[model samples]
Target: MLDPLAALRTPDDPPCDVYLTGSVFLDIIFTGLDSAPVRGTESWARGMGSSPGGVANMATALARLGLRTSLAAAFGDDKYGEYCWESLEHGEGIDLSLSRTVPGWHSPVTVSMAYEGERTMVTHGHEAPPEESAPCDPPLARACVAALRPGEGQGWIAAAARRGSRVFADVGWDETGRWDPGDLADLEHCEAFLPNAEEAMRYTRTDCPRAAARRLAEKVPLAVVTMGSEGACAVDGGSGENAEVPAVAVEALDPTGAGDVFVAGFVTGTLAGWPLADRLAFGCLTAALSVQEFGGSLSAPGWAEVAAWWQHVRSFDDQGRAALRRYAFLDALLPGPARPWPLRRAVPTIGFRRV
Candidate 1:
């Protein structure tokens, strides 16, 4: 048995660039569907492909951006579980050695129906509980939390934070019905708390994203609430200040996993030591790029592509443009292709459309 307290004091090694522990799933997306059919009606769907989704997509996005990332999540011993592990292991910059494969239970899966780039999904896997013990090191163990119980997840998060690892927590919808806000003591130790607008509203019982962000900031160092087209707002606990970051306009092909991608970009930018405004812009940029493609992980842009898009958008002198450019240039260390028509097309209200 591992000494839980001793593990918390383990030396901070740079072997893994970033450690991410959360939900992983196999997403089957069907594009070109106008609408979902009735329960008894069968309709033919077109353009099908399988890709990583959920937290797995966030991990992949970070890895593709040259971060030596590791995934510490639960996987069943079944075929779908194996597919998830194999996909992450095969991808560049991802270390899956810490991932555990349990003997029973079905791995998470989702089926998405997309119409002209917009998507709706039906999912399953909430019933399956993750295994408590599996082969994992101290760091990986700190990352994976099998705690479906009220206080369990926060305990693991606390352990990770004590070990000097920068922690980002995503509060999913599963906790909406049952989670008590007081139980989230781990938020006090985390570097950032990212929740979708709906989750923020539920957690704080406030309809305004800004108010929710302020409420969250009272508990954590930084609180960010993502407002789809309205962009995102962040509250800094250190200064009691709030910043509104505008969302980049782009034709959203599929909004699935966009929030997760945004978290990925923001966390990655934070890890890179970028300013708050820049981090938010990078997050919005990554999310915009994600909706441009069909599947979640498949649609995420690599470091080169993101850098190119940032440069293309930076060559403008509009309001808030300088902050956006500085944020991109600071985090995007490598230079790449520059996009033409930086301001006219990049900062639109609806975003760029696919031709």
Candidate 2:
């Protein structure tokens, strides 16, 4: 297993760089598949793994990037809850002091099937605790990562913003087809609002990603729309400047948590005071590296992997060099060529032999 935390900052650090608030889930991932299973056919996966999911994926990604990360979420008293809590606190070095585990409640779970560079997931969860009755104290970190919901999210976001926290807000796909822009009222208190291409377009009533991003930018300080293979585009609401970054080329294994990783990368770049283009480039790079592996939180690439990739890319000829110049911010993060962590599971699970 790779020890990404070996170079982490001291535990006594005052406040973390990012604070995340969302549901914590146990993800059981099945990998090494060429295609989806047919009806009534029993398909066997070559590999199986499990790890923390949901906002935990973002926390792990941020921590892997050397950011002091903290998470505040309710958990269950079950063994799976303990497993996730311990993994986040000890394994990833995330500060979970503000998180709590409720009695009798079970942690949410997601079963993900990975095939052909994509994932099909089925999630199971109990009714969440009321948002008004938070389990623990809220964190006041440099940035806050959260999902926007109607009755929830905005309260803490407004509170965090009042105290100068940069709120990085994201939204999930709305199956309800009620992609009402008013649902995003929380953006008024957010520093940046990021949504996938489909979500953005639907929310903005636009047919194009660029138009969606530009429209959303009018409501928030920054708006970003992520298009899987097409890359990402962003609009700065204040200066009206817009930028686009192409997706990094990679053989994606599982697309699960790529969006969360992208947000983590963008937050990391933003906290480092990088320019808009560099921030988007770094975000795209971080996410591309993630889909090359398996599992959600476990698949995030550490600084070592990033540094190593930069070193390899720099040796490319003129054509490749021009294409890679967008990732120039990497030089500032890594001064020299560095070794890449061996591609292996950060959190591995025992598997059963096929019959």
Candidate 3:
């Protein structure tokens, strides 16, 4: 079979392979704790990190996978904004040609506290006055990751789909108790819709994850519901083929961006035309590796890490390797044994300050 990725090759340097758009924020993360914070108690964290957050998480993950990713979002003219813009564009190699900076506005900020495998986040930002029109003009790419809001992004998602772009849409948790499926009308424009188990259940008014996945599959071409620890399930609306992959087991340090990293892996596999089971397996591994580190965007593993893990799994003795046989598909995706893919250190989480 011809490689789907080969058709996407570009003569120009760094052609956009994936286009992403959504809110951008600087994230301050606090890790290392035995339990949740007690009010009025001064607690010290073992480690602290700060990096560009929100959509930056997905952008960084995609870029680390060697995809030419572009982000279209608004930034502030403030120092924090400049720092985030530089980190994502220069450090992560994400294309920022479509982004904008608004003078007098301050960049959004999120403070995340990771304790006992999960995290709690608090965000702060002022809503800028609405522009006469929407801020983004959709860019053409082989695939697009759409950050959805009720009544927003519908047009752009449709336009991207009309142009044959694969749209993978993710929605935020609805604060209102009403998780109406009517709000998901935009799913018609998306090639795939990825929602966590809770969100999927709420949206579908289903009692369980599998039921939610089935209901979602009824709407979109593909439906994936992420069940933390339990792994994820996907159903193809066209063929009615459904599959689930178990989560890769690992000692998690922080689970901040695991979901986004999973999506990035799935997106990479989808773009490469990998089999559905392989795509889900790859996503699970990507997320498993991500939680072994701290911070959001900076924690994502690169292709080098994937290659290293593949080698490590194969080198295990028969008894040790028995558990990882499920991931044998990784062997085909990895570099040849003679070709060494060196693992590079992850980008440090740098505080945003204009210097």
Candidate 4:
């Protein structure tokens, strides 16, 4: 991948641009399902792809975009874990110095069925044993991405924040059935809080997602709410900046990791100091490109995809001036002598190992 931030490199820069830690899952995606499987019936899919998922999804997305990304997670000592480890560390050029392989542990697996632009997933596996998970000592980086659950904050988040690492957080569903904002104490240390529209509304107790964004902004410096196909909105409490951008239209194959991809894009733009709207648009563009492919991490679009998409859009006569202007930042950021390929997507399945 071309280095988008090459111009900003300094002798004293951090060793990594993004540091991530979470569970890694082996994702097997089945697309083109005509319908949801009926009870007692076998459903066949037209396509299948495999890749690393969970935290690995965000890590891959960030690395593919030329971010120096480090991942800290537990990998099972199994073929599945080997495949995921190899894909992220070797194929995607992510740093796994903080990650470990757990003996006798089963790699978590998620079987995703894509149908009608949505997916149904069945996942199996146990959490990594505490002793086998990532260590408490986090690496210093420009920023870190953390998933805030509906409970006490992860101690590492506060630690990283105090260490001058910008923290960006994504929220999952409130399984406890209590959408208590106080439960997310970690947001205090986060530079941004990203939640889906439904999750935002529930957490903020607001019927409207936009209002929820405003409410969340009070808790975090930046509050972003993704509204699926409609697009996303962000409120920057610090600068009083708010921006919304429409989703780029594309036929989605699988959305398993699209949210992760979007967050990666947004973080990339934010670190680059792009305007608020550009950040949201870049994030949305990356996500739109992601779904057009298959799988999760492997389906992430690198610079190859971004340059190709930009060139293709520029060649067209009808692409609006506004659309071009909105993403004009890419014109200056794309590395010199760049060439576009159809894409740099990984194979439909994890490629076979050579002897």
Highest lDDT scorer: 4
lDDT (Cα, 0-100) at 168 in candidate 3 = 97
What TM-score, computed on C-alpha atoms, does each candidate reach? 0.78, 0.89, 0.90, 0.95
Candidate 1 residue-wise lDDT, 7-82, digit = tens: 2243754566577767778788776576766688877775566777767777776666556677777786777777
| Per-residue lDDT of model 2, residues 225-344, tens digit only | 999998899999999989999998888777889999999889888877778988898889899999877777988888778877787788887745865678776665675433345633
- Which lDDT values do the candidates have, in the order given? 0.68, 0.82, 0.82, 0.88
Q: For every model in order, what is the number of clashing pairs?
A: 4, 0, 0, 0
Over all chains combined, what TM-score does candidate 3 have?
A: 0.90
Measured by TM-score, how close is model 2 to the native structure? 0.89
lDDT of 3: 0.82
| Model with the higher lDDT, candidate 1 or 3 | 3
- lDDT tens readout by residue for model 3, 1-355: 1122665576752357899987889888888877888899987888777778899999998888877799988898997799889889987779998888988999999888999888888999986555567744477788999877854446788888887788999888887767888888888889999899999999988889988999999999999989989999999989999999888778888898899999999999999888898888888889999888777787888867876777776777763385367787766655643222442223335542458
Pick out the ten consecutive residues of candidate 3 with the lowest summed lDDT. Answer: 337-346
Which candidate would rank higher by TM-score, 1 or 3? 3
lDDT of prediction 4: 0.88
Give lDDT tens digits, candidate 4, residues 1-355: 5776777889999999999999999888999999999999998888888888889889999998889999989999999999899888987889998888999999999999999988999999998888633457678999999999787669999999998999999988787899998898999899999999999999889999899999999999999999999999999999988899988877888888999999999999988888899999999999999998888887788877787778778766555455587788888877543334553454566667689
Model 1 stretches with alpha carbons more than 4 Å out = 1-13, 103-106, 115-119, 126-152, 175-179, 311-332, 337-355
Steric clash count of candidate 2: 0
